[model samples]
Target: MDTLLSSIEMLARWDVMAALFIGSIGGVLVGAMPGVGAAVAIAIVLPVTFALEPIVGLTALLGIYGSSMFGGAIPAILVNTPGTPVNALTTYDGYPMTQRGEARRALSLAYSASFYGAVFSIVALMLLAPFLAKVAPMFGAREIFLAALLGIVLVIVTHRGQVLPAAILACLGIFLQTIGIESTAYTQRFTFGQPWLQSGVDLIVVVLGLFAISQALVLLMGRDKANDLPPVAKIGFFSQMKDLWLYRRVATVASSFGVICGMIPGVGEFMSQFMSYAYAQRSSKTPELFGKGNPEGIVASEAANNSVPAAAMIPLLALGIPGEELTAMMLAVFYVHNVIPGPQLFTQHMDFIYALYLCLFLLNVIVVAFLFFATRTLMKVMLIPNRFLGIMILTFSLIGVYTLRNSMTDVAIASAFGFFGFILKRLDLPTSPIILGIVLGKLMEDRLRTAMARVREPLDFIDRPIAFILFLMIVLAIAGQVWTVVKSRPNRKGTSHD
Candidate 1:
């Protein structure tokens, strides 16, 4: 009760309110732009925060971090473009909903679920962060390898019918990740003697190409088709609220997974969203509804991704260890403010910690408020001509990719991948698994190699209970996929005969 009172008192300050408001708007704008994510937004604002009081500055930064997460969903749903890479899962069902004239419903569900999920995670961070942090270090190299392997397996399973093609793309992604210098040896592996390839491909460049640029190319090729806005029902905000309330189970489960994943070092929002969506699909009553405008899919993806930004702060605050890239940036902000995070943080800065929690909760409320009031204006974006919209997306993609490293080689890599992504799209192969491969492959390789170096035997990983459980989960996932395929064969044959 004292903590709650202190947080409420801290939040009542005018400067804090103004800071959060401005930061929220900036975050939404930055997040709505492709390739510019929370990391970029926060990094840009980090220097500015040094001039303000600690509560005010940290609250502003937190606002940007939390709001930008849901901001990414805006472009994702309307344009099949993810504003942030983590939002790639949103496109699977969100874009389909827009095509079916349910953009408002999709957006509502995404924002609402995102808010609720963040609430869950923030509460968990307040209550369980310390305990979770103590256990986090127990996740060794072998355990990390198993977790990443599970991520790869779950991503492959997301492609229901195109398993083989998805596997191939995943392998290609892994292969691409190996193009730069080897992490351990520092020697070049696949650079082909080119200086540009020495540093390897950037994930942001690949993500922009795979999602934003390739989507633009598809639009350009289909330029003759008019961008038509379908008629939408006059659904009230309360109606949308009711819909989201019905999916509370999904939001809860996904948020829980997000918190757990956030406690593990090196695991990003991608794995959390991927695993959540997979779990939702398997547990859903209408499993076929996924990837086809299912509200549950949006709920799972948005809730899981949004849940991550706050939950990620857990390891940072409790253990002085960054959970992912974005949190690493936040750690810098902490240092700038002369605030040291660790077990002593609660004792040394209890007020700031509780205020941080409250600030995060309010950030969600503010973003949702902006969305509600601006929905009609924002929805007009869907009516823009495809040619102009496509050109804008391509421009953003190129600029976003180029600005990352200021190298033409990066631009070329993105362009090449854009064309390749279009080709893969035409072939009906899933590109997401490729992304999963690139993102998780390097981590899995480093961890597996480290684990192997530590042990003399091949079966040593199973000696650790957590590693053993993760391996068992991987085997179960494979077995489940096989069973699903076998179960579908008879039904497929019956339909063919009929």
Candidate 2:
């Protein structure tokens, strides 16, 4: 009770409120742009924050971090483009829903779920910071490998009927990741003597190509125009609140997974999103509805991704660890303020800690409020002409992919992948597992190599209890999926579902 009072009192200050308002708006716009994420937003504002008090600066940055995940879904829903790479899963159902003229429903579900997930993580962070921090170090290379493996398995399961094609694309993605020089051998495997390929492919470039650019090509070839889009429903701001209430369990489980995964250093939003979506599909009665405009899919992906931002702070606040790039940037700000985050931070800067939590909570509220009121206007995006929108998206794709590395080679890669993605789409192949593979493959390979190097025997990595349990879980998941296919064979015999 005392803690709550102090936090509320601290958050009521004028400077903090002002900063949060501005930061939340800035974050939404930044996140709505493809390729611009929270890290970039924070970096842009960090310079200005140097003149303000530590609390104010930190509050603003937290606002950006908290709201960006929800904002990323805006583009994913209205267009077939993901503003942030983590929003790729959101695109699976979000864009399909948009095509069905359920943009309002999709946006509302994303907003509500994001707010709920952010709040859940904040509460968890307030209560379990120390405990989670202590447990975080237990996740070494072996555990990380398991987490990556689980993600791959779940993604494969997401495409139940197209498992073979998805697995092939996934393998291709992994092969693409191996294009650069081999780490241990110091020799190139697929670079083919090209100096540009030595650095490997960038995730952002691939994401833009896969979702944004390929989508533009489809729009160009299609007969439909943007103005031909279905009219937005006249549902009020809270009309979809019932759907959110109905899926409370999905939100809770995904949020819990987010917090748990986020607490581990270097495990970012992708793992949580993949794991939560897989879990939601595994448990859902209408599992077939996923990837075809299901609200639950949006809820699961948005909630899990949003939950990660706050839970990510747990390790940063409690153990002085930066879980990912965004937290690493926050660490720089903390050091500038002479605020060392460790065991002493809680005792020495209790007010700041409480204030930070309060600010994060309020940031979510501010973003939700802004989005709710502005949703109708945002949905008007669907009314734009497809030709113009396609051109704009193509331009955005080119610029975003190029700016990430400023290399002509990267631009070429984006164009090539854009074509490849379109071909896969025509073939009815799932591109998501490929993107997932590209994202997780490097981490998996690096971790497994490190764990193997340290252990004398191959099985030593699985000797630990955590690793052993994860291995069993993987086996069970695979077996369960196989059984599901075998059992459904009778039903699918004549229909030939794929």
Candidate 3:
């Protein structure tokens, strides 16, 4: 109780409140505007936050991460376009509701369901805090290495359709992390004797290029499409709140699904959305109503979507492992602030964790209330042309990257990655694995190097309890993926012959 009170007192400052407010508004606008995702927004804003207090910076990012999905549902419903990538499933039913003149209803349900999911996930995580404190200390070097290895394997196998491509990109990201001289050996691995290459690649630089710049180019150069928003009925936002009770079970189940996927090392929102949306349909008596404006679908997708951001924090804070890209970016924040997450944090700085939880809780209230009154105003953001938004994003990159390193070389590196990102997007390749591979790759390398000295053989890598369990899971996941691929090959081959 004393700890909780102190956390609240710590947040009772002007800067913290301001960060929350500004981040909330920024998140809504980003979500209302198509193609401006939270990752790019975080990447652009990350440099600026380095100057602020650590708690304040994290609060701001949390605001954006927690609230954007609510805003994303707006474009999904009104324009049949997802403002954020996770919102793609929302359009399946949300847009249909709009076409039937129930836009306000769809928006309300999304907002409410999102609120429920975020709250539920945060509460669940809080309950797990004691458990995590007990468990985090058990991670030895071998266990940590095995966990990172499992993460790499999960990254490779989890992409249902692009397993090969994701594996290749994951390897590439792991390789990129090896550019500088190794830490213990002081050996140059990939520098090739170039003085400038000694620093290797910056994660922020890559993020700026791939998410910020490449996305800008895609918006700048790609043909713009017309978005005709359907007519909305005369309905107050509060009117739909009553309808949400009808789908409470669906929302609860979806939120559970979100927590499960978010806790997983490599799986994120899409997987949760897929699982929850499917479960909702399968359980519903009117399963056929799903793809045609069913309120249940919106609830399932948004509830699961919002739940993930908080739940994804579990592994990150507990074990020092980032499960996905957003957390990876935030991990950089922790490192930048000289605040390491994991066992030490779990045991010593429990108050920091509590403060973050409060921020997330308050963020939901602020964003939901803001969306209630400001959604129509926020949707106007989408009216700005992609070319203009793209230009602004580039301008942001120039300012942000310059602020980061004060070097034009970083900008050039970002440009290279931006082009690479555009090419990956054009090829429909996944980008998350690349980032994950980089983050976990370093962990695997350091831990593996340490474990190597203590080990007798390769089998000894999984000698410990946690290490053995993780290794088994990795093997099972890989086997399952292979079996799936082999099972589906004959069908594709038969289709080609036909």
Q: What CA RMSD would you report for each candidate?
A: 7.8, 8.7, 2.1
Better of 2 and 3 by lDDT: 3
What are the lDDT figures for the candidates, one per model? 0.76, 0.76, 0.87
lDDT of 2 by residue, 1-498 (tens): 676687778788899899999888778866775555665466446545656788888888888888777678888887777767788999999989998878888888998899889999989888864564455556678776776677677667656578888778778777878888888889887888888889887665666677667767866776554333344554455776777998999999999999988876555688889999999999999999999998889999999999998877775675565555566556656766787665566655666787888888888888888888775565454444556656766777787666655788888998888898788868877776666676567657877887887789868878988789878878987899889988887764468547
Give the per-residue lDDT digits (tens) of candidate 3, residues 115-178.
8999999999989888988898888788887787887888778887889999999999899999
Task: Pick the lDDT winner.
Answer: 3
List the pairs of residues colliding in candidate 2: 226-386
Model 1 Cα shift for residue 495 (angstroms): 15
How many clashing residue pairs appear in each of the predictions shown?
0, 1, 0
Which of the two, 1 or 2, has more TM-score? 1
Better of 2 and 3 by TM-score: 3
Model 2 bad stretches (over 4 Å): 1-114, 125-128, 223-363, 491-498
lDDT of 2: 0.76
In model 3, where do residues sit more than 4 Å from their true spots? 231-239, 491-498
TM-score of each: 0.63, 0.61, 0.96
- Candidate that scores best on TM-score: 3
lDDT for 283 in candidate 1 is: 93
